[model samples]
Target: VEVSGLPPNLNRSCCDCGVYALKYIESHMLNLPLDLINEDNIREARLKLAVDLWAASKDPVLIDRMEKYEPHNNSSDIVDVS
Candidate 1:
């Protein structure tokens, strides 16, 4: 079944397209409103997803790499991966 009224693919990049697809599916699954899903805040959504995934990851190598890339001075755990 096709989902209607999903946010338009404004960026047109493969990465952005994937993000839109997943978000649309997720909203549909959760019976959430689709209005919040838009191009304007997709970058922020993507960043949040990345941080969440990174935090949840248990791979030692990836964790080490993330630590190197993530800021060490910040007291907050969230990485500014943007």
Candidate 2:
């Protein structure tokens, strides 16, 4: 969504859209079989989604913003990617 590229204060719509999608997916998962919802499968799915999303964006500012997001827990992981 273009809202993802908006300033943080203006990004609520995009963030809520993502949250809604996740809630919908979770509801689907709950009704699905246990044999298909493994941790490895979820992780792989997340990675693939992230890669595909990154590939779809052409904005340098958004790219730079994404580089600043740290997946690990630590202050040193912080980066001024912008």
Candidate 3:
């Protein structure tokens, strides 16, 4: 639905678009109202995300994924930076 009457939207028209997108998916999945996440409560959402990630950090799968992400197989691979 192109709104010709309205001015064209420039790039990054919406601030924190990624945040909004993640919130949209979360709301849709949880059957929660999208309005639950807004500018005022965005910080709360981020804090919750941080808490969730921190809690999951102890999960073996997540730890393994992080381990694989480091690509350095041996201690010799790491340069000794004094």
Candidate 4:
């Protein structure tokens, strides 16, 4: 698939390919028609649908790194690594 609108810095490597594939599958699966999926065949249908949609859709952007500008904790206390 040829995914567009991806960040220019997005990572594309074999190490992260599976992660990208799963994300793509999840996104597509959410929009699947309810009538096309049922309890008895949901498993198979989900896999098939995901594959088909992924094949037809564009390539996904796989992020390998991101810059964090702020601290996650509100406490000012610091821990000594030593």
Best by TM-score: 1
Off by over 4 Å in 4: 1-4, 12-14, 31-82
lDDT of each residue in 1-82, candidate 3, tens digit only:
3211212342133656666667877777887766576677776776787788899988999899888885646665668789
Q: Which ten residues in a row have the lowest lDDT in candidate 1?
A: 5-14
TM-score of each: 0.55, 0.30, 0.51, 0.25
Instruction: Pick the winner on lDDT between candidates 1 and 4.
Output: 1
Rank the models by lDDT, top first.
1, 3, 2, 4
Q: How many residue pairs clash in each candidate?
A: 0, 0, 0, 4
Question: Candidate 2 — what's its lDDT?
Answer: 0.52
lDDT of 3 at 56: 100
What does candidate 4's lDDT look like per residue over 1-82, in tens digits? 6343534433333344444445556656686433332234445544775787776555343222223245576877887989
**Top lDDT: which candidate number?**
1
Task: Rank by TM-score, highest first.
Answer: 1, 3, 2, 4
Per-residue lDDT tens digits of candidate 1, residues 3-77? 485444465655787777678788889988887787778888899888878777978888788788955585767
Q: In candidate 1, list every pair of residues with a backbone clash.
A: none
The ten-residue window of minimal lDDT in model 4 covers 59-68
